[model samples]
Target chain A: NAGVTQTPKFRILKIGQSMTLQCAQDMNHNYMYWYRQDPGMGLKLIYYSVGAGITDKGEVPNGYNVSRSTTEDFPLRLELAAPSQTSVYFCASSGPGSNQPQHFGDGTRLSIL
Target chain B: TQLLEQSPQFLSIQEGENLTVYCNSSSVFSSLQWYRQEPGEGPVLLVTVVTGGEVKKLKRLTFQFGDARKDSSLHITAAQPGDTGLYLCAGGPGYSTLTFGKGTMLLVSP
Candidate 1:
């Protein structure tokens, strides 16, 4: 169904490099989120957007930025890659509701050396 | 900050075994969700419990929400190899955000 699609399923970056992770959803959900999952840890929110042109920082927003220029696309940017930033990135989207379940993409496995 | 604690961080059992994983929190939540994540994949929604003391069943899996809305449990009856995955619990505090537990890794061997 292509609910949420993430590009670059795997990527490797050198220290101090920069890159943008692409995420797009076809469900027309208003809520989009970016999360990083580390080994043996739970998913940590990096940023979120309630709708196009409206973005907010989540629990862990340092070293990252996000833009929601359109309802379907929300991209996360890393200005400078750090070793600590190496983790699997997940993009999720959910319809408007208090209890709507989030649909997630397969995820992008990122590594910084 | 609200935190969800999942017990039995790792579990290994043979086929036809029954096991239960737990998610506990001190803070009350408006809703709780269960997700299953396999290797190289993102978390997939398994179920969501909103009301207190609510119970939902999906085939061999049963989910329960505590009456106080601060805890939840997932019980699997006669688990199979295909059921092996990481089980995560997330609590919603009446917003779009969710506080997630570390998750329990389950491995079922046939």
Candidate 2:
């Protein structure tokens, strides 16, 4: 169904390097989110966008930035990659509602060396 | 920030056996969601409970929301190898954001 799509399934970046994670959805959902998952830790929200041109920071937003220039795309940027930022990045989207179910992409496995 | 705690961080059981995992929180939530994640994939939503004291079943899986909206449980009847995965619970505070639990890793061996 191509519900949610993420590019660069795996990537390795050197310390101090920068990169951007791409995420797109075809469901036309209004809510989009970026999360990072560590080994035992659960998914921690980095940022979220309610709609195009509107975004907000989540619980853990340090060292990461997100932009929602279009309704179908939300990209996360890491200005300077750090080892602590190594994680599995997940992108999710949900319809317009207070508690709608989120559909997630496979994920982007990122590593900082 | 609200936190959800999932009990039995790891579980291993034989096929045909039953198991139950718990998700608890001290803060009340407007809704709760259950998701299952595999080895290399993102979580897939299983169910969402919005009302207090509500129960929902999906074939072999049963989900229950606490009367106070601060706790929930997932029971698997006769688990199979295919059911092995990480189970996670997330709490929604009537907004777009959600607080997630660490998760419970389940292994069902045949």
Candidate 3:
């Protein structure tokens, strides 16, 4: 069912470079989230969207931006990549219910040098 | 901000051994969820506990929620290598956002 699909599974970028981590869900969910996980650390929220055309900054939003132009796509953008931004990024989606369990994408391994 | 603290950041046990991991927080949550992640993958949902003092079992794994809804535990009766993963605990504050603990990395060796 391709619950959640993320593009660019792996990428390497030079300092000051920019890139977009693409995420799409076909479940017709209303909620989507972007998170990054450092080695040996828990997932940190970067941004979230409750529905199309709506977005909100999460706990860790520095150096990143997000847009929700459609119900199926929520992309995360790194304006100027830095080494500190190197981590595994995950995208998740959930139904309208606040208590609904989240479905996650495989992840995008990003490295900035 | 709500925070969750997990103990024994890392654990390694032999197969068939018994072990328990804990997730505690000072903030009350409407519900708590447990997820397990393998190398190179996102965390996968294991279970969710809502009612305080509730107990739920998933085969050999048992999950319990504290009476105050601020703590939870995961117990493995007979561990196996397949059970090895990074276990994360998240608390929901009756909203769409969730606060996640650092996580307990488990390695069940054969």
Candidate 4:
């Protein structure tokens, strides 16, 4: 059914480089989010968008930026990637609101050296 | 701050055994969700518990929401190899976004 799809399943970047992690959902969900999961740690929300043209910052949004120009896509941009940013990034989507469960993408494992 | 914490970070048991996983929080949430993630894949929804004192059951899996809505628990009866995975709990923040717990990895061997 092509739930949530993320591109570039794995990547290696040099310190200070920049890249964008792509996320797209066809479920017509109203909420989309970007999160990072480090080893032994839970997922941390980086950014989220409620709908097209609306976005907000989450717990760890310092080095990341997100844009929701379309209802089906939300991409997280990492500016000046650092070694500390090495982690697996996940994208998720949820329906109408408060009580819905989220569906996640497989993830993108990024390693910055 | 991270809002959720899960106990028993890792668990290994024989098939047909029983196990319980916990998720606790200091903040109140309108809803709580459980997700199971296998290696190399994203977390998949297992259940959603809303309202204090709410309990839901799916086959051998039983989920309970704390009476105060600040904690939850998952109990699997007679666990099987298919139940092995990383179990995560997520709470809906204010209106959107979810705060996830550090997950419990369970290994149910045959």
Candidate lDDT values, in order: 0.94, 0.95, 0.93, 0.92
- Model 3, range A31-53, lDDT digits (tens) per residue? 99999999777989999999999
Q: What share of the true interface contacts does each candidate keep?
A: 0.63, 0.70, 0.59, 0.76
TM-score of 3: 0.98
Q: In angstroms, how far off is B7's CA in candidate 1?
A: 0.8
Off by over 4 Å in 1: none
- lDDT-best of 3 and 4: 3
Deviation from native of the Cα of residue B108 in model 3, angstroms: 0.6
- Compute the interface RMSD for each candidate structure: 1.4, 1.3, 1.4, 1.5
Question: In candidate 4, what are the lDDT values of residues B36-61, reduced to their tens digit?
Answer: 99999999999999889999999999
* Each model's DockQ score: 0.72, 0.76, 0.69, 0.73
Where is model 3 more than 4 Å wrong at Cα? none
TM-score of chain B of each: 0.99, 0.99, 0.98, 0.96
Query: Taking the tens digit of each residue's C-alpha lDDT, what string does model 2 give over A6-40?
Result: 99999999999999999999999989999999989
Model 3, span B1-83: residue lDDT tens: 88899988999999999999999999998999999999988888999899999999999999999999999999999999999
Stretches off by above 4 angstroms in model 2 are: none
Candidate 4: list runs displaced more than 4 Å. none
Collision count of model 3: 0
- Candidate 4, residue B62: the lDDT equals 97
lDDT of 1 by residue, A1-113 (tens): 88999998999999999999999999999999999999889899899999999999989999999999999999999988999999999999997643789999999999999
